[model samples]
Every structure is written in structure tokens, then in C-alpha cells.
Target: MPLVRVDAVAADPQQLDAIGDAVHAALVDGFGIPADDRFQVLRGAAGDRVVYDPGFRGVDRDDGAVFVQVFLRRGRTDEQKRAFYRALAKHAGLAGIEPRNLVVALTENGLADWSFGNGEAQYLDDPPS
Candidate 1:
């Protein structure tokens, strides 16, 4: 499973939808994630949750970029993460922003217990047993 969260300023619904669609496409198409795999997306405005660096600022007050965090059941290699970041950046329309301005983070852990198929099947171990 992969969960994606996006944080930014009060984003347009269309933009949010587009970002979700694009992220799903990148994961499924570019990363070859199985369609049956679970993927979750959350988008929210900055509000009081985000804090900017004092020395850096943007010309457009409303022009804030998205921060994407992906959580998964297993970890990816550094190369894989870089590729995913590139793909996500393209999907999120973050091309023009400086590399340092964009942010993406990933967290991974083995699933000790997860149910599927009405609890008929459970995942409870790491890989290569």
C-alpha cells in the first residue's frame, strides 16, 4: 500500500484532483504498482500547519508548492526514490520551482498484520522469508 499526502495553500479542487490523478498514474504506470494495491491520497491547505523559512519567499503569495509524502509497506532504494520524486514532481506541476523548493519524503515499514479479502488473507511478515 502507498499513501500520498499533499500540503499546500488553499488549493483549487481541480488542481487537487489533478494532482491525485497524476500521482496515481505515476505510481501505477511509471512505478509499475499493481492496480489492485491500495493507494490513498490526502490534500489539505497550509493554514497553521506549515512554516516557511525566513530567508526564502515566493513572488506570488498564493504560489505555494505541494509537499508529498509517501508511506509504504516496504522501503525503496535511493534510486527508486529519486525516480519517484521526479515522476511526482512532473505530475504535481512543480517543474518551474527550484529543486530546493520542492519537498518529498518517504517512510516504509514491514506490515505485521494487514487484512484483505474480508479478512481471509493477512500479511504478517517481511520479504524473502
Candidate 2:
């Protein structure tokens, strides 16, 4: 299960909820993750916590930018990641958020690093349930 974190400028809770749902859908569709394997944190910042170059990467961004960071086990291919990004952009765009304002960051870690509960690194010895 990937630990997802979404950060964006302060906005209505409804909009933030939509963004979160869209991002989760992108993850499930692109990575083939289980539908219920969802863990996400949505942060609505007040000040300028998110800074980006309006023209960086040849894309323009505004203060409404939404930053998504996904922390997962390291096994996905580059193609899978690209598909995730595309799916995310498409979903977020449909919610009235500009595609250019979305930034996705992927971070990977080993299975030994996760502890679902009971202070146990459960997946370290076997495949995840």
C-alpha cells in the first residue's frame, strides 16, 4: 500500500476531497493496487508552503497548484509511473484544477521499512497480503 500525501493551497474542503479521490483513482488504475489499499493525507496550506516555477518544465502553474507525493515499495517500472501521472492529470483536470498546476513526486522504499501494526515489519519476509 502506498502512503499518499496531497498538499495544496487553502481551498474549500469539497475541492480538496475531489483532488484526493482523483489521485487515489490514478494510483489504483496505474499501479494495479487493491481498491481498499488507500492511505492519504490532504493538507491545505495557508501561506506559501508550496513554491514552483510558473514556467518550469515548460509548464505554467498558479497558486492553486496541487502537490502529490507517493511513498511505496520500489518495484514499479518507468512506464507505470508515467501512466500514473497522466491518469492523475486527467482526473484532476476534470475537477476544474488545471493540469499544469499538478506536480507528482514518487518515492520508494524497501518492504522492510513498513510496519502495518503491532510493531511488526509484516511484509519483510513474505508477499504483502
Candidate 3:
């Protein structure tokens, strides 16, 4: 399972949901993750709590910037990551969010890092099929 965290400025619930769906689709398509495996945390910060570089890396973004972070097991190739970024940007763009205003980050960990409740590490017991 991948844990997603989205940070934005006063984001609408429906919009966030759509963006999340797009992010999940990218994960499924690029990382080969199961379509059913989804978990997310979306937060719309108040005021100027959400800060970012409007022109960092030569990308022209505005105050309506969005940051997405995904934490998952490590193993995907560089090409796979590239595919994910592209897919994620496309989805976010459809939501009226500029590609430059979107930032996607992926954090990878080992299988042993997950605990799927019931005091059990299910992932370690039965790895992804």
C-alpha cells in the first residue's frame, strides 16, 4: 500500500478527491500497484502555511501550488518513476492545476516497515503477488 499526503491551499473536497484518484491511477499504472490498494491524507492549509518556490527549477508556478507525497515500498526503476510523474501531472492538469504548480514526491521504505493492523506485518507475511 502507498500512503499519499496532499498539501494545498484551501482545496475543495471534490477536487482533492479527483486529484487523489489521478494520483492513484498513476501509481497503479506506473508502479504496478494494485488498484484496490489506496490510502491518502489531504490537507488544505490555512493562510500562508503552504510555502513553495514559485519559480524554482525554472517552473513558473503561483500561490495555488500543490504538493503531493507518496510513501511506499522501494523498488521501482527510474523509468517507472518518470512515468508516474508524467501521469500525475496529466491528472492534476485536468483539475485546472498547472503542471508547474504541482510537486510530486515519492518516499520508499522496506517491506518490514509496514504494519497493516492486528499487530501483524501482513506485507512481510505475504508479499505482493
Candidate 4:
């Protein structure tokens, strides 16, 4: 399961929702992840957080398109991340845009225990199980 957090500048609520849906589709439909697995997507405004280099001027006009950064438990290979980035770019309607223009960050973490069940039951902490 991947917990995705999307950060962008000047993106509207509808666009944010679309971005989240696109990420989920890329993970589940494209990556073969089970639908029941945990996937959380959080959207943050660009003004709320900085998304530019110190000497860089904004390339996105009013930051119209959403910029995304993904975090997941470490285990995904470099090729996998590249593929995911490509898929995300396509899903985010950024196919023609330069890859460098798109910002994608991946954070890794050691696996930990998690459960998604009623109080009366317990389940194994297998991702996509």
C-alpha cells in the first residue's frame, strides 16, 4: 500500500481530486495493486508549501497544473519508480511536458505493522494481500 501526498500550486479542488484518482488508477489498475489495500492521497496547495528552487522563477503559469510527489515504503526499484513517474505524467496530462518539469519525490520507510479490519478480527500486514 502506498500513501500518496500530492503537493501543487494554484490547483483547484476538482483538479486535486482528479490527480488523486489518477494516482490511484496508476497504482491499482496499472500496477496490479489490490483495490482493498490502503492508499491515502493528500493534496496541498503550492502557496502552503514551496515548490521551487531558490533562484528559479515559476515555470507553471500561476502553477495551473498540479505537481505531485509520492512517498512509499522502500522496496520499489529504480525502474519501478521511473515507470510510475511516467505513468503519473501521462495520467496527470503531462505527456508532452518535460520530465524535469514534473517533480516527483519518493520516500522510503521500513515496513511496520498495520491492519484494516473490525475490532473482532485481525489480519496479516501484507501489502496488496
Best by lDDT: 2
**Per-model TM-score versus the true fold:** 0.68, 0.92, 0.92, 0.66
lDDT of residue 80 for candidate 1: 73
What are the lDDT scores of the predictions, listed in order? Answer: 0.60, 0.87, 0.84, 0.59
Write one digit per residue (lDDT tens) for candidate 1, span 35-127. Answer: 766466656574546665523554233345556676766756777777776777675564333334455677786665344456533565333
Cα lDDT over the full model 3:
0.84
**All candidates: CA RMSD (Å):** 4.6, 1.5, 1.5, 4.6
| Ordered list by lDDT, greatest first | 2, 3, 1, 4
Candidate 1 RMSD to the correct structure: 4.6
Q: In model 1, where is the ten-residue run with the lowest total lDDT?
A: 54-63
How displaced is residue 58 in candidate 4, in Å? 13
| Candidate 3, superposed: residue stretches over 4 Å from native | none
In model 4, pairs of residues that clash are none
Q: Sort the candidates on TM-score, descending order.
A: 2, 3, 1, 4
lDDT of 1: 0.60
Superior candidate under TM-score, 1 versus 4: 1
